[model samples]
Target: MPFVNIKVSAPEPTKEQKKQIIAEVTDTLVRTLGKDPAAVLVMIETLEAESIGKSGLSLEDLRSKK
Candidate 1:
């Protein structure tokens, strides 16, 4: 079994978008690693912008500046 964890800071993805992500990621693992699609697990986490930072700035702050 293969497990994939994805994280993003944002308002959150729509259900269709998330489904696409899951499908694509599963396909990638199946093709690249020869994993069984039924045995692969993909998890998506939507974190608070305030909790995710880059270059010393929180994602919330970065978005505000943009």
Candidate 2:
């Protein structure tokens, strides 16, 4: 079994966006990792803005400081 974990700053995703990302990622893993796409598990978690960063700044503090 192959396990893959992906983390991103959580954002609202539409159904089409979700399906597209899942399909593409699954297919790539199937080819590169040589694992069955069906065996791959994808977990998406929406994190608070405080936990996400951009331009070397936390979203939470960046807003207030700016």
Candidate 3:
């Protein structure tokens, strides 16, 4: 079994995007490691932009710069 955990800052992915992510990740594990799709676990976690930072600036701040 393969477990994949993905974390993103704010503005979570849409349902269709999440579904695609799960399917693609599962397929990758199946193809590369011979893992069963049924046994693969994919988790997506979203955090507030304020909680995630880069270069000493929060993601929310970075977004504001854009």
lDDT of 3 by residue, 1-66 (tens): 678999987699999999999999999999999998899999999999999989999999999999
In terms of lDDT, the poorest run of 10 residues in model 1 is 2-11
CA lDDT, every prediction? 0.94, 0.74, 0.93
Reference-based lDDT, residue 3, model 1:
91
The regions of model 1 sitting more than 4 angstroms off are: none
Worst 10 residues of 3 by lDDT: 1-10
Q: How accurate is candidate 2 locally (lDDT)?
A: 0.74
**Rank order (by lDDT, best first):** 1, 3, 2
Ranking by TM-score: 3, 1, 2
- Model 2 Cα displacement at 49 (Å)? 0.3
Question: Any runs in candidate 2 off by more than 4 Å, and if so which?
Answer: 53-57, 63-66
**What is the model-wide C-alpha lDDT for candidate 3?**
0.93
Model 2, residue 20: displacement in angstroms? 1.4
- C-alpha positional error of residue 55 in candidate 2 after TM-score superposition, expressed in Å: 9.4
After TM-score superposition, what is the CA distance of residue 27 in candidate 1 from its true location, in Å? Answer: 0.6
Instruction: List TM-score per model, in order.
Output: 0.92, 0.65, 0.92
How many angstroms is residue 29 displaced in model 3 relative to the true structure, after the best TM-score fit?
0.3
Clashes of each: 0, 0, 0
Show where candidate 3 strays beyond 4 Å.
none
Error of 3 at 1 (Å): 2.2
